[model samples]
Target chain A: MPDTGTNDMTEILQTPLHDLHVELGAKMTPFAGYDMPLQYEGIMAEHNHTRQSAGLFDVSHMGQAHYTGDEAALEKLITADLAALKPGEQKYTLLLNDEGGIRDDLMVSRPFGEDGLYIVVNAATKAADFAHMASNTAGVGELRIIEDRALIALQGPAAADVFGALLPAAAEMVFMQCGVFDLEGVELYVSRSGYTGEDGYEISIPAANAEAVARKILGDDRAKPIGLGARDSLRLEAGLCLYGHDMDENRTPVEATLMWAIAKPRRERLDFPGAARVMQMFADKPARKRIGFTMSGAPAREGAEIVKDGKTIGVVTSGGFGPTIGGPVGMAYVDLEYAVADTEFEILLRGKARPAKVTKMPFVEHRFYRG
Target chain B: MSVKFTKDHEWVKVDGDEATVGITAYAADQLGDVVFVELPDVGKSFEPGDEMAVVESVKAASEVYAPVSGEVVAVNDVLEGEPQKVNESADGDGWFVKLKLSDKSQLDGLMDEAAYKAHIS
Candidate 1:
């Protein structure tokens, strides 16, 4: 089963678009302390709809912050080389604890003509993540959590066309580029980036105007409001990691197969948090490595055990039906020996051992638009 | 033949000692897009409340329970290839199994069509 990452202790929060989701007949579920839409029509239909056109996602539960400080203060905590980040460019990076374990995965961008770096972190880790950044960056710079904004992602093939019709200049931005634009007098910080491996833009809008902008976008024939259900499947098919599942505080970037996200300069400098241990892991190779696999029969879900010859070697972290591939696809952290493509294994589901094999990810190929 | 429903959302159609079983439309609608179904083997005996089958949607897997004690006599092989049948016609062609009832008195404990509808509503 897909983990909703629901935190029950906190009072459930609602996004600005919560009413719109309810009006659209969404089945709401508690997720990361917020009541969010799980699906609209159905997961299969919405999953297929997004692969064909555009799907709007309310990612407002995610934490967004602005940092104006010495770049070194922030760079020390993450794996990215902030000094090398150019205006209008974004980098996927990881925040690490002292031991080199990933605290959370996030996006850091330099909005075009903006004074400070713009960062986005996962919802479940936001509170602690913000506190960590605030405490660490004390006096060197300021970390301002942007509570007045709401983030929305318009993803899939037709996203550009649907969103571009509103702001012509946005269509010109390539993948990983960020810019500030005006939409009917509302300022939007938009980045050509998304969790789905589709060509898309993540728009940060003022909370008060979010519903109006979302309604206007959904007015187009190519766009529909997608929920967390399809969002999980889409990202799984694209081989994107979901924080708190695929990787958490226990796994380092090296073990999660996210070494590419660590910039070359940062690697050479070895200045980022846990750099020594992470680099050492890079050299010695981690005992366990993340891998992707496809299998027939029932989908193996998170916490499912993976075995090789009756010996447990790994555990599934993310899994479900890949509507695009028409079969089961999942990710697991397995013994380094079993992480190779074509390495056969068995996944234990309900006490039955179903045959599986490690396969290269993007179980469906990524279609990011790079200009 | 008389139709009975279980609180777990399965429906049983009794004809003498044999009964046909499937999830109710309300259950199927709540599941949304059934993608896989694991039926029990024919001849397997099950007690009431036993997990007789597993129905998987794109999002989750749910166990279908035996409302009355029985031995599986025949399984719906079509669901193996087209599980969406559960969503399309959950009460008809999507029927899960044919059970040889072990206790006819168990049928009396289940709800009738009207009672089942009222229970769901």
Candidate 2:
């Protein structure tokens, strides 16, 4: 049964934009300890609007923190090459468990002017991630959670233009570049990176100025407030993983097919957490690998079994109808042999097995503004 | 003449020996953006509580159950081409399947519009 997440409503947290969401007639749902907007106008409308123009999203519920000690020592916990990152550069990386499985996927940034590394993690795993960092990397660096900040992602083709209107400096930054901009007398740390495969910016602003800044952006007719529902579809269409759904603590980097994020330099040293076990995965390949699949018929949801020749070969981790694809799309883990692209299989949705094919990802082409 | 509702959120409108079945607007509001609808074949018969159809939204899929047992006479072919019609006109043109009522008394057992409204609230 899917978790409604509505059980303990009293204790759920609220972002600074909570009242703003309610004022805009957003459908609110409890997610990852916060009552977040599920939709604004509607998922379909917001999703299409983002693809065509720009969509402003309140992702303040996600965890934002900073590490303030030895940078190389802190690098021992993440899979990415943090040491080589120039100031103002961001790296997408994974937090690995001792067993080589992914605890959470996150972004590490060497923010301009900041003496330490800036990190953003999944909302659901933030508590655990922080705890792990505090205990394991104790003498190396101090992890300080930035609870007073609010994170907003302005994504899609028009994102740069929107930010350009507010802060011209941010608009000039290339993808993965971070800079702190003064917006309406408040400091906003803007990064040219996002989960959606779009030319966008993720701005970390103070909680006080979030509503005012969000209002200023939405005041522009080119952008609208998008909710979590459309955000999920956009990310899924971009072939990005939703930490708990697409991957979890049980999935290793090799199994998740995220070798691209493991920088080449890090491969030589292999000094990160679970490097020994992760090396074992490199020596002897993972039996199963995650693949993007085209789902027809009834859309295969998470937990649906993937079957081939009357045998269950894999399971879908994240599956849903892709509005852009005009069909169902999913990410699943299957036996390495069956992981080949174009390989056909049947996904058992409910009690019925429906035809599906292993396909390449980015159901939609990533339009990240690469410089 | 009048519409009846099931606890599962499907509605049926009976006239003569045939009944038009579709999900209620409340259900559609709950589901949010119906991307696809899977209706049973025309000649198929279903029993009350049987899962006869499937409705998929962007994020989740739901099974539309039969509120009353009957043989399907027709289905909304428009839905096959444009499923969003269910979201556009959920109760009107969005009607799922027309069924030949197997048991007329089943309608009396279901909730009336007033009762459904009160049930939802």
Candidate 3:
């Protein structure tokens, strides 16, 4: 039973393919407005399966939007300096609130031509992204929200071989590049980027072909349908943030340990929204920074408080069993002193403090296909 | 002979002075894939309901409790590397610990397979 006083099930939302998850014996739970599968065969199995083989993920709930303005004029609309975005190159960036808070972090890729651009935003913040983009596009040419498309990410070491055979062109695109291709008769915008620290591809196709194409990929002996449970763990192992959890409007990229997403030109020019505050933050050094840690006891779940020497310092954003690391791993914000790698702290798990230590991000090494 | 279960979902198969401990199949299924098992040191003694071992899955961690008061005589070393065997054969080959019972009277407090099933359902 759910915590009666805490969660309201009626307010929970369901995804477009909620029934399909049920049919596949997925254990469902509320996640970011959608009733998503926590696991199917199990989180550990699915996690390990994806690491050693291939795992099929249903990520259709993510927002897909396209911007069609003359490529030469696109640089003026986005917060990032899109003018420098060479065709086929992708960059991780964030849309900022006027006050310097992160509206959402996203992947922006210029597809075939300079005239058309595609962006993938977090599922929970898609509404705000659409609203922001819609308002901004009124002055530009046209901003089209591709609501009819679905995204499926096949992630793992074997992802290349599995996806390579299906779309030869896609297999050739190096990490952070995009290619338009077809798999099993369904056309898609396949990108060589993923949250898991593995060589993988995120394929965007028409919603009509979502299930059919997913089934076809899962038909491969190396691929097994994964669920949101392993998805969280996989990304955790890869040190990727889960938006609302690790970052939000109240957090800046620098504070979130995502300074790399900000370009040098933008940082120096201070042209983006909240640039003054972000620039100051970089100059002064943010007080609290996101850091990774490993818990010694029972998994320190979300909302667990972090303490050092009996005083509360921070709170865990995402914490749970990391199959790849073979222990409980999590991300949290702490006093800069405790954020150093190997700095010991304690996680208050169910009221009992357990020993924990700060560690480097990506508990598992990333394996992007730079080749 | 009697069987008892802890709320943590471990079971103790008691036969007089000997007790065999393992996680219930239901618990194993709910846990999904078992990646690693931290076995209690052999000869370690614990009472009923004490967390004796750690079971890790991809998403969470669970405690395997002692079903009855006893000293662990042996542990399933095979699980150190092949923890998935618990998901495959949780009842037999996946048995976690063999304890030399400290009190045989504890067996009377346990439930049979049918009763344990009803309790879980």
Candidate 4:
């Protein structure tokens, strides 16, 4: 029920696969600007099924756009190294504000045979992100938002096998590699990557063929339709952050513990947005850092306060019952002193302080392909 | 004794001064699966419309409000270990608590089975 809005439900947008989702009996809710599926089966069953087998998710709500022209031009406005990146490779990076706060975390991909780059950004900030890119990359590169395509993710251990069963060539692809493949004459822009820390693929298909491909994918014995409810839980268990909840316009990537996404060259040059302030944060160290923690009792939940020695030190950003962990797991921004793994703190839940311990993330170990 | 439902989806079955309380099947299905329930202890008193219990599904947490002013005389002990019973039998064995009504007149405000069925649709 993350941002399951209670306001007037008016003029909500629908994706290309909206009809299929409704036909499959999905519980639809307002997400971002679209009427998206929250669940097909129950959240628990769908969550466990994806972890054990394969889950098919309709991620078309996320914004996909292409920027054309000089690679160095758009690269200057964002964090990832487009010039250094090999064709068919996609890297996760942040779209930063002038103050260095993350506007959105996006995957910048350089498709083969093109000087322009394809980038996937978060759904909520797509408008703002497009505007930012259009203005900043005007002379160097031009941004073109892609709305005619639908994005679907086939995730879990069995995803590759299931996807390969449809397009045998897809099974041959390695991790993080992407390419355009003709599946029965319908073009599939596919990448071997996903949000669930599992072996999977995110396929960009034409809006007209989305329903047919999605149905075909779900036809596999291992693949089942999953919803946004399970998507959040799987990402949490994988230690991935949700925009607006985990980190936002107020916090820098350094403070969000996402310094790893910054390339070595970018760090060396230190010329990106708020580069000086971000570099200063590196030297001084962040006052608070995002940390994973486990707490007993009815989940610490989002907005629960973290306490140490009876003083508020932090707040839980994203949290819920981890079906895999069989316990409540959550992520929080905690004081630097308490960010260390195994450190004990108190999570204030329902007016009572419950015992909690900071731990290394991916509460469930990430099973992404190392190769 | 007759079953009555509140607009918030709570159902109450009244018998003399005692009443059985639980959520309707419509509410249970809407909530998906019940993983954990935090019902008030026996003997706890609540005014009409007061939140007296917490119900957690895998996706979210919700509050169960008191349909009518009453003192909880007994609670379903089975829900603690097997919360799925609510998903299985939302208005039957899954009753959250048995209440001793303090204001019997509050019953006038509740909807009958037909009206509840109509109200939900």
Candidate 5:
């Protein structure tokens, strides 16, 4: 919607570092309207490199937006009860349609001093998210979408060290804490948060500076530009959900195992959009809960059916082989009765029921650095 | 000793009565990142072509078929925790299983390395 297209008329969008990716011999694929790298040095190799050291991700496709207004007016719009959040804290929230379905899942951060609130949403849903947010707000806060920023994440065990060497200001920022800084004359909003199960940093900088910054980080032998393939696997290993796959408008926060993101103040007041249905779900305890499973014969992918006693009960949301866990792992919505740990179920794969069991998430242990 | 390949892209390096089995480099590349591999139990017996292992990538899962009829005598336990080895060196170090040839004549059915390459090409 913001004219993020290339000069070519193919309608296939390209990231700011498209040339860089090509130079690195990356295999590119169309994702979220952008022609993104699927892998470089191969997906398996990149995945192992990230788990063992550090890997760079070009996530410029994610959307960046801001909310500006007085407290009362701002509170009237956003579903999250933001007034309750302390400065420097970030909360995961969602935009909702009138029917109480989620529009997109996002992270809202209360920047220091709180002149305004900053948030990021999924790239695939960003266009719709902006339109939905603009149309649904009750003339409260003026939503400003940042279309010129490029979002990139450097993830894995050696992320901190990589950032410490390249950008000292980013090294000092604690996990979930973000601040503005100048990197070689380029101003960037740096935060220590990532979907990968590794200690990492997410940097938001002007689109013009993306290629140079990416080059600087990738100059290190320990850092490689990972593609969407490894990104999905890393997040899967971390037990993080992919918005359109693991969650959508039809899914509720509670049913998605993201109830922790809902705040107590909002729950008590039930003041935001979709409060009635979400609150009722909170009270009644949804009939189904998202649970992790380990497939036996083969991997169960998204939309695969989950069966119990030969009856279809749920569907697989995100399924893939977990590198860290050394097996095929996935998350699915199953009957509350079969959501507990160690509950045996069958995943329908290629018309065959593969033996599987509900296991505790994440499939692998997370290594986020709080310091 | 010579190597032969199956239609599913698995390869077997046969030496007299013994054979070493693994997937081809092309197959590994197609699978994307090799996160996990479930190998058949040791001592399992199978014919010329059988599903002896399952390889899972971040993208999908595929079966590793036996190129020659044999009895599985050993499996690569290292794959249990380091499946990436398969992608890193699918032919050299990523061998998945070792088999005791039940019928050495079965090796004639699989394609040679050059033939396998041509098939993939």
Candidate 6:
């Protein structure tokens, strides 16, 4: 289970759309130091709604910042080749600790004609992430945290149709492309990328105008307000990793099955933080590899032990029902020998070993718009 | 027949020494979209507060505790295929098990419909 940390109600923070969420009858829960909506109508309903239509998600709790000055300064800290990241393009990258462990996974984008990079990090680790970036790049670049902005994602197959109606220019951009757009006088940084495995956009608007813009998009009949519950399910089906749950400070990118995020040029240079260790893992292959699996019976949630022939091989990191697939799906890190697809294993749930089998990821095919 | 409720959200409907058990509508609503259920075996005995079954939602798993000491007379096998019955007809066709009461006195301590409603409210 994802750690829904126990937060003192008095100190919990609220996003800009807190009132709007409550107005929509969202069940509020504390997540990442913010009092966020856990669900609206319900998880299943919201999950299906997003798959069939467009869903709006308030992700303002995520950290957004502007990295100005030297691109090399920023590249040194992450795995992505920032120099190759053209204007109006975005890349999913990871911030690695000196030991090659993933500190956080983030999106680094360069808005059209912009001088600096627009970065968004996970909410839970934003403070530490910012501090790391600031302290590391002090002499070369400036890491300006964007606290006055609110981020929201409009996702799903119908997202393009609903969003295109508002801004025709933005709708034309393909996946991973981003640009600044004017939405009825509101200056918004819109990225044609999202966590859900659908063609969508992540829009960053000034905190003050967030509600107005969100309400405008939600005004469309095809779009519904989604909460964290469905957001989690959508990403899980997409085979996307949740920052804290899937990869953490102790897990390296190779072990987490995210080596593709490391740009080839960076790999050739072995210049990013812990590049030597990461490359060595690439050559030797990590002892444990993350794999996706499908299982029957109760969902094998995080902390469930993965067993093969009565011996503990690994453990589940993320697991839940994949609404799209109509069954239980999850990810786990198991001994490399037991990570092959179709390999049968047992997931110990409540002391009972339940049958499970390794399966290919993105249990649902990704429908990214690449045009 | 007298229907009694547990604070844990289980409902027990007694017909003589035998009783039918299921979750209340309130409990079903709280556990959105029942995807799977693991039923206790028939003939198995459980004391009050013991885990009788496991109900899984799309998001998490919740344990259904035994409301009173009883021996499971029959398990709801239909739930294995159509667990959503718990969400659709939580008090009717969604019954999880029929139990032969091991201790009838345990039902007296449970809340009646009126008190259950008050407790939830």
Say which candidate scores most in lDDT: 1
Rank by DockQ (best first)? 6, 1, 2, 4, 5, 3
lDDT of 4 by residue, A1-371 (tens): 24856776478899999999999999999899899999998888999999999999999999999888876767766788776878788899998887889999998886644666788999999999999888887787778899999999999999989999999888887888877888898988898899988899999999999999999998898999999999998999999999999999999988899988878788889967888899899899999999999876577789999999999999999988888887789999999989999999999877878899998998998887656
Candidate 4, which segments miss by more than 4 Å at Cα?
A1-10
Two-way DockQ contest, 1 vs 6, winner: 6
Each prediction's whole-model lDDT (CA): 0.94, 0.89, 0.82, 0.89, 0.81, 0.93
Question: For all the candidates, what are their Cα RMSDs to the real structure?
Answer: 2.2, 1.9, 4.2, 2.4, 5.5, 2.0
Runs in model 2 lying further than 4 Å from the true structure: A1-10
Q: Name the 10 consecutive residues with the lowest summed lDDT in model 4 chain A.
A: A1-10
Residue-level lDDT of model 3, residues A227-282, one tens digit each, is: 99889989998999989889988998878988787777777777777888988988
Off by over 4 Å in 3: A1-25, A69-79, A139-141, A183-185, A295-298, A350-353, B4-23, B34-56, B61-112, B118-121
Docking class of 4: medium
Between candidates 2 and 4, the one scoring higher on TM-score is: 2
Give the Cα error of residue B53 in candidate 5, in Å.
8.3
Candidate 6 chain A has its poorest 10 consecutive residues by lDDT at A1-10
Better of 3 and 5 by TM-score: 3
DockQ of each: 0.83, 0.79, 0.36, 0.63, 0.38, 0.87
TM-score of each: 0.97, 0.96, 0.82, 0.95, 0.80, 0.98
In angstroms, how far off is A367's CA in candidate 5? 3.0
Error of 3 at B27 (Å): 1.8
Models sorted by lDDT, best on top: 1, 6, 4, 2, 3, 5
